[model samples]
Target: MCGRFALFTPVSELTNKVGAVMPEREIHPRYNVAPGTWVASIRQASEDSAPTLEEMWWGFRPSWAKGKGTQPINARVETVATNNYFKSAFAKHRCLVLADGWYEWIKNSSPKQPHYLCRRDREPLYFAAVYAERDDGGLGCAILTEQARGSAADVHDRMPLILDDDSLEHWLAPDLTHKETIHSMVRHIDAGLVEHWSVSTAVNKPSEGQGDELINPL
Candidate 1:
């Protein structure tokens, strides 16, 4: 699961690649992103509108399910299409969680060995996600996860659904609501293109969350 990750890349640099109207709020860089905190997400106001960058709560709890008292940070891809809590968002509110990389732990380690995963070239990453409006009016989001692949499988059995650059437009197309079309047209970044390294356990502590050292290989 993508419980903790980082996204210090400037929004100014992402405009070209993400094809979104940048947010007006000054976004500070974050080295250790945790659930419950707001993070940058690329989405559309409507099917006819251009994509835009906005701050979104990291936990997802649809307004209709507010009484359930749950805010999940990740949703399993396998059940996302049929699960009542996620099917609507999966079909209509699809979105992208912007990040530089993510973290995973080896459960058997004395103190789990945390590893940072990112592109070999260190470019920005777009994670498949879905969002909903909370009763309080906040936009909450949940990252999509599937069986781990490539080196990510070595650290954990599940990993965030990383999207291929070419599929960004298709994934955001509002008219394409059927899961069948999404599955056939959208694609995940090749697992082989992603890489990881052992990092300071500082990432394990959200309080020591800022600065580049947290991602520096130990």
Candidate 2:
């Protein structure tokens, strides 16, 4: 699961990289983004094919959620299509979660160590996610997860469902609602597209926010 991530790229760079128009909000750089915080995501509107980038709360709360509980931070690809919390969004509210990289903890005999993972060539990546809007106009999204592949499996059992530029259409296409098409679009990202490294455990705390300390090697 993608519990923590980074998005230090500037808004202008992100717009050009994702080929989406940015909103007017004063965007700040974030080197250690955690769940429950607002982050940028790209989604298409029905009237126009151009992608619109907007900020959305990281955790996902289904419209049917009752009382306060842990909103799902990640949705398993294996069960997303059938799970009540994710089915509706999985079928229709697909989105691309923009990020420079993500963090995962590796458990060992000692305390867990945090590792940063990004595209091998240092290019930006977009995680395939599903989102829903509440009546109050708040937005929430769930990062889709699949079985870990390549070197990533050494650190964790699951990884976020990442999409490539070529697969962007299939993922963002609103008309392709068939279950088969959706499942096909949810496959693991190519291993060659990513790189990883160890970083300081300062990111273990959500309030640490963005700083060089978080990415500094211990």
The C-alpha lDDT values of all candidates are 0.89, 0.79
Off by over 4 Å in 2: 47-49, 66-70, 185-188
What's the true lDDT of residue 111 in model 2? 60
* TM-score of each model, in listed order: 0.96, 0.90
Q: Per-residue CA lDDT of candidate 1, range 128-171, in tens?
A: 99999998898999999999999889889999999988998888
Candidate 2 has its poorest 10 consecutive residues by lDDT at 61-70
Off by over 4 Å in 1: none
Worst 10 residues of 1 by lDDT: 10-19
lDDT, residue 98, candidate 2: 83
